[model samples]
Target: MKIFKKSDIILIFAVLFVAGIIFAISSLEKGPPVAHIIVGGEEYKAVNLVDIPEKQVFILETHPETIIVCEKGCAYFSSAGCPDKICVKTGRLTKKGDTAVCLPAGVVLTIEGGEYDAVTY
Candidate 1:
């Protein structure tokens, strides 16, 4: 007859628990790659998100008459001659769903995320 000790079972469980914790920590350490898109009448792909500095000022020059300044992860239409200037009031956008639309200049800014190799494909 084979006998199993309580200490042995506890040791096995503890080892498994520690392994699980380690795996979870490693997975959490991985972050999603960033993406950037310049939205106009159609979606125009921009350079990788890494190219854009975070929490910094950026100027986006569009055709016609419009300029955008992105700061602190949010971009707003700072200057525009559009009749409505609605894009200016749209304010800054930060999250993935956030967007800035410049109707007059026919420009838009959007952010998206997907599995990327950090290299242009």
Candidate 2:
């Protein structure tokens, strides 16, 4: 058997490293492309969240005291008479399974879909 040179070993490792990174990036790009926004038990279907326009806002009126505005995958309690602004502090939600809840206002924001056919839990 022939002896392996140091340069050959280094070259092999570099190629393996680049291959791993390419695999990871491709896998990340192949997942589902839907975001589910739920407010007061109602679900809104949004596709390709990154493509949402900056100024396009959605208003959700769950109750007289609860009003939410969602624009570009970010949601906040624009107007709420609730005692706590917990929902507002929850910040923007973009990933699947993320949620924001306002107990007093009875509103819930959630993201769904990940190797599952339907949204549950």
Candidate 3:
């Protein structure tokens, strides 16, 4: 005697298909998120990336000062006074979990994602 029937197989496949779709969609990010700037290993500034698509420029009053620019939903250090402009060259961080580090300036810019905080600890 067969233990499984044709309907059972179809239902199983359908459930698995829907579950896969739900998982994929849920795993995607909610939307563009804010990025946190860390200075000297301490949280310094929080900027919402979505608002920066206009490519506006600003300054972060770090010890050496960091010039920041936002463009296309990404943020980066355009200029700095550190001996090595590594942070300025690191380029813009756009996606969640993307990070740019400026060791000389003691700055870390990390993308914010999901419910958990990227800066609190």
Task: Write down the lDDT of every candidate, Cα atoms only.
Answer: 0.57, 0.59, 0.74
> How many clashing residue pairs, candidate 3?
0
Q: What is candidate 2's TM-score against the reference?
A: 0.50
Q: Which ranking of candidates, highest lDDT first?
A: 3, 2, 1
lDDT of 3 by residue, 1-121 (tens): 6889999899999999999997666546665567788888788778786545466676777768888776656778888988878787888777776778877667788776643323342
Q: Which candidate model has the greater TM-score, 1 or 2?
A: 2
Q: Considering only N, C-alpha and C atoms within 3 Å, which residue pairs clash in candidate 2?
A: none
Residue-level lDDT of model 2, residues 24-100, one tens digit each, is: 65444433334554655676545444445664444655554655555654445566666777877777665555667
- Enumerate residue pairs that collide in model 3: none
Top lDDT model: 3
Name the weakest run of 10 consecutive residues (lDDT summed) in model 2: 111-120
- Which scores better on TM-score, 1 or 3? 3
Question: Among these predicted structures, which one has the highest TM-score?
Answer: 3
Q: What is the Å distance of residue 11 in model 1 from its true position?
A: 58
User: Against the hidden reference, what TM-scores do the models get?
Assistant: 0.47, 0.50, 0.58
